[model samples]
Target: MGSAKWIACVSLVCLLGVLSRGAAAENDFGDFSLSRSEWSSEYMSLDSGHFLDRKLLQVQPSSQTQLLAVRGDRRDPLDNFRKYRGGYDVTNKHYWASVVYTGIYGFAIGVAWLLLGALITLGACFKLCCCRRPKVAERRSRAYYWIPRILAFLLSLFAIGVIITMFVRNSQLHDRAFKVRDSIAASANDATSTVRNVSNTLSNVDTTVSKYNIEGLNSSTLSSTVRNLNQQADSIDNTVDNNVNTINKLINGIEITLIVLLSIALFLVVMGLLSALMGWRTIYFLIILLGWLIAALTWILFGIFFAANNVTSDTCQAFSEYLATPSNTTLDELLPCVDLATAASASNVVRQGVNNIVAQAERSLTQIEQTSAALGRPVTLPTVCDPIGPAPAFEYNSNCPNGTVTLGGLPGVVAPFVCAAEPVTQACLGAGQFVSRTNDTQIRDLSSAGQSLVTIIPTVTRLTNCSIVYNTFEDIVNNQCPPTKRALRNIWIPLLLLSIALTLLSLDWIFANHRNKKERYASGRDPEAYNNVPK
Candidate 1:
């Protein structure tokens, strides 16, 4: 009988589910009928799918037909450049085609024609027993050499374009990148500050917890544990603060370098153009100096990567040490430190103390309001946090200068403040003034509670940002620095090689002078022919 009832119940549920879904389906199609149809949009239409990822869809009214589209930032500069290079057809096909047309077809063909005519005249002289001088070969040779010089000149022009492009893209890159860096830095600062706050809160919590003796923890031993936790927090704070500055400087230096590179490219281009057009012998030597400049910038990036890696390794080790079990140590001995994992857990004693304090505050506030009522004076129960204007300035100190801010601190307010304990001096605080006084106090107290759990949030965020640790020191052996480093090497190293090559090619003019070349040919010292000329 039970089994039969169970089967009947299941069948009834299935029937109900099917009927409900059918009703829902019918409701869905209610807006569209045979004769009339209505269109209601939840999200706006996005048409630039090819260029952008997910865009913010507009919420349209009944009369509106189109939605506005939002755009995001561009991809990495190097990736854009790779596509741009292809778009401009800077490939071997074009490069070799240019070389072939200028060298093989134009210069080579014209030089051969001159040489053939010169040879024909020399042959007639020998055949008619009227020996003539060997043909003038200097001008044709110089023009032949002009082709490679022209190529060098073109390479320099391309370098200038690359420099300008890099400057523009790097500026864009910094515009986007610094925002990310600032965000990461802000998180690191907040995390570091929070850790320190927790440490200070722990000291007060331990004292409060000991007074109630809620757990079987010894006051002295608990103090020792809190001290250890605080020490670790301090170390982390120092490390994070130092590395943040280092990373900021590294990024700023890189930004400035793009401009310096642009200047250098402009200078080298002027030198190269002069070398090719006017045969400026000294100008070719400047390429050697340009090569050295490239090497210096390359090494600086490597240094930054090294520093980040070193910091990462030390942080990982310290974090692991804090998490590991102490030798023959009891759980009571390492209360806070033992629980410092990627996710840290707070003690019940701290939670109890916070509750006790909050209860005491509530009672105090009630007593004041009751006394006011008893005296027949106006009593505002549950006090409103209306700011009585900016906090009063201390007797000796000056007022806030020139401007007012709502967050952090007011200009004249003293440091080491507790919420609502001290008067605020800042102007321009509206709802926030009340928030700091009334509504947020409980939430702040809850955050201050020891029993809450928090993920070890700072390590991964700060470490992985710019791969501060891995790229700087740890991951170099494994070849895992930011791909930008490799892309930069690809650009500057080839430039250096070209600089050296062009300088070497230009060395020929140093040894063989233009004036001496014709003299040697006229004196038969050029060695093209051994036939003696009759005087």
Candidate 2:
């Protein structure tokens, strides 16, 4: 019974080990199969089904998959705007219409306010200078005399509060502007670096290919392809640089302009308040006119920011849709997709070249082995992995005969044989020369060149596909837009309040001046009764 139990336990352990290994093998195979399927699907649109095994140039599949997953459904850019605007089409037409209407409204309100204040001032001046008044006792109550004064004092305090709020909001706007500018600059710099790296890699590939002297490997086609890609990369780099620089300049200009304008507005408001307190009619009137002008300009700025917000929202929507499905969009004109056909062709050429070089090296090794055996030297060399068959040229074959020696491993394997202390003969000389020609460094360089070409495909794709730009736009929309819009609103709303307060303060100055003149005239008319009159 003890022996039977031991046998059963051994059998169970063996079975478990087999099952575990089989599961691991199954998982690895499944992963490879899935990867192969993805490569095929990605290239199917390019109509290059023959090059589906080129998995290295898969175009940032993980990012694309994540973006698609995040964007579960297509979205329209104008949806929210349409709902708010009562189903109005949110096109350039809508933007222009809003701008025009807002501008006209602001202009009309500022002009009307200025004209009303001017009329009131003229009336007060005319009554004081041109109109005749009866010399009679003032019968108005004390409450009537003090009410306007108290109201003017309260309004002036409110105006000060509004100005302080405006200052706070303006500071917030400044911070928001800098934040946006930095965000844009960071994104642009990343995109420029990516393109520049791709360009340099292509140049390196060209140089590496030119240096290769592998037998039976044709690299002319590959060199031409790399040159073409390099040109495209340079063009893209220039375009991105120009666009980003222009945007940065615009942001800086807007920032400086807003700072100057707001500072002037604040200065004018402060001066107007002092003028009111000191009862300076000329200075008060001047401040009102300047305030009207600033108010009009602020409204115009509000309209502009509104239009920009709409355009940005539209762009975000378009970008989101592009992320979901990258084809067929106007954005392609700005950020073009890499030429998959050209990339695939380059990959195929590299693979074929590597295969040919390996094959020729293997043949040379076979020749060396045969010659050594015939000469009784009998130098045993490891068999090189043959990548040239009906299967994919780039697919690694681990099941190669007699301990697979890769292109990278060829030099190490041949080194001992070449340095072996033996009789120096014609065969030995040949083997030594072969070793020099097929040195490890040379093979490694070739392999590295192929790898450089492969890796750059996805990078170029990411650049041309505008995936980085898309993510930037996403950040702008989700993270930056709301705060910016809020800051803009905060700025303009406070300006509007300040305008109203200034208007009322200007009228109070006019009324207070008239009241003082009336009192002085009454006092001069009856000097003895001036003590009884309200002073």
Candidate 3:
């Protein structure tokens, strides 16, 4: 019994190996054959019965093959030329059949790819959302260890999606080629039938004219009859010529259309073939999706970390102390926040407040000095106008000479003046005015840009992560995923659900096998039934 079990396992392993090797071989050759550009290259199985007769017919010669001998300006070269025509080319028909066969092969590959993609996607979803082992299982693997596997699986899915898309595109081209071939064939048949009918009608007319003794009638009447006959013959000749020209035009159109279609199809196949040569896994699509999910998770974690570390009250206290103390003045030096103008034009409420505080302190000090001066009554102090009334407030300007200052004028005072060692030039004054206006606008513009960037950055980052979702190609390749998606939430969701169901089914099958084994051991005395059971 142990030996038989071992043999069964070995056989299963061998079968799997064979299947894998077979698929690899097919893929390698299929790509090469599809990519080849030889004129004789064909996709149909030549060994098959259906193609044998077609091959024979293609090689055989027909009466219309001689029409090429008398080729002229396609003018009225021969009267009966149209009545016995054949197809223009045999090679074109064969090329089309090859295209059809190639398409069938590609379609088969696509079906396999779709199944593989679903399997891989399901595996990834299971790794993400489900436990490695069942909840009731005794042993469990750590989730972190499985992360790499999940990423690898997803990447494999992505590559697979690309391969499938390529295969589908190739198949579509092949189908177009087949359609063109069929159209050409149908047109040829129509032309042939029309020509045969005309030939038969003409032959009958010749026989009737011969049978009748019209030349033995009255001289005048005979001459009239002959003239009418001559006119009718000319008309018949013209009609036959017109019909033949129309058939030739139809043939030319079909050939041109087929050639164009075949050329495009050939290009697509070649491109797909070259792309597949690189050693790449087909399941890399799932990896891309997994990558996005990882990014989203990373952001969620980062946001949590940032929130947890924030100390609002402490931050406020630190900010206030930092502003007040000169000991810790690095931030002040770095930022260099002067009392920036807040109003429209040159008004700055903040600068005015600072000036008020400074002026009040100075006046008190000055009064104390004057009191001492009065109490001492020493040498008479020269009366001096106070130079400490209000420190001049300057409006911010981009083009102002360094250290140029502006006085905050009262309502009646003649506007404001720029103060410098040298009187301000007209050019300088104009520059300063332009600078002030631009500075004000720039500050506002910078603030707006900053706010916009802050708002949009996180959203843009999230959208970048969401882009992986669009990398999906199940529907695009064969439209298999749409039905699956509509039937469920998405392709992955159904695949995940199905995987769980299959796992359960597999386990049930295993358990049933165990149960049957126990039953057979209990009744091993009946050796025939036990043997049959194993088989």
Best lDDT among the predictions, by candidate number: 2
State the lDDT of candidate 2 residue by residue for 1-535, as single tens digits: 2211110001100000000001111211011111111122233222222223223333445332212112112223334323123111222343334323433444566667656656766886898798867454465666655555666677767876876776677678767866765675566556656645654664575566455443222245434544555565455456545554555556556667767776777677567556644556666667766765676566556555544544444444554565554543344333334444444444344344455556555665676677567656677777766543434233433355767776656666655445233334556565543333333344445555545644554454454333565566567667876787677677666666666666666566556544433343342466445456665
Select the stronger candidate by lDDT from 2 and 3: 2
Write the residue-wise lDDT of candidate 3 on 1-535 in tens digits.
Answer: 2111110001000000000001111211011111112112122113223223323332335421211112122211133323312111112332222222322322343344345545756886798688443222122233322333333344334433433443444344334333332332333333333223322332332232222221111123223323432343344344334433443454355335434433433333233222222212232332233333322322332232222112111122223343232121222111111111101001111122123222322332244345435545222222211111222312212232333221211111111222232343555444332123332232222223222222322222211121111111111213322222232222223222322322232223222222222123332244344443421
Give per-residue CA lDDT, model 1, range 1-535, as digits (tens). Answer: 2211110001100000000001111211012111111111111111112101111111223232121111122121334312211111112242223212322222333344345435644685586686545553343444554655566566566656655665665665455435434544444454445445545555564443343322212255345545654565565556445555555665577578756755665665566556555655455445534533443333333333332232223222322332231111111111111221111112222222223333333443454456445545434534211111121210111233333321112111211122352343343122123223432333233223322211211221221121222122232223322333344444344434433433333333223222223222454455553233210
**Candidate 3 ranges beyond 4 A from true positions:** 1-144, 167-171, 203-210, 213-535
Using TM-score as the measure, the top candidate is 2
Query: Residue 106 deviation, candidate 1, in Å?
Result: 34
Clashes of each: 9, 0, 20
Shift of residue 29 alpha carbon in model 3, Å: 76
Q: Estimate each model's TM-score.
A: 0.37, 0.63, 0.17
Candidate 1 backbone collisions, by pair: 305-472, 306-472, 308-469, 309-469, 309-472, 309-473, 342-456, 391-424, 391-425
Ranking by lDDT: 2, 1, 3
Please list the C-alpha lDDT of all candidates, in the order they appear: 0.34, 0.49, 0.27
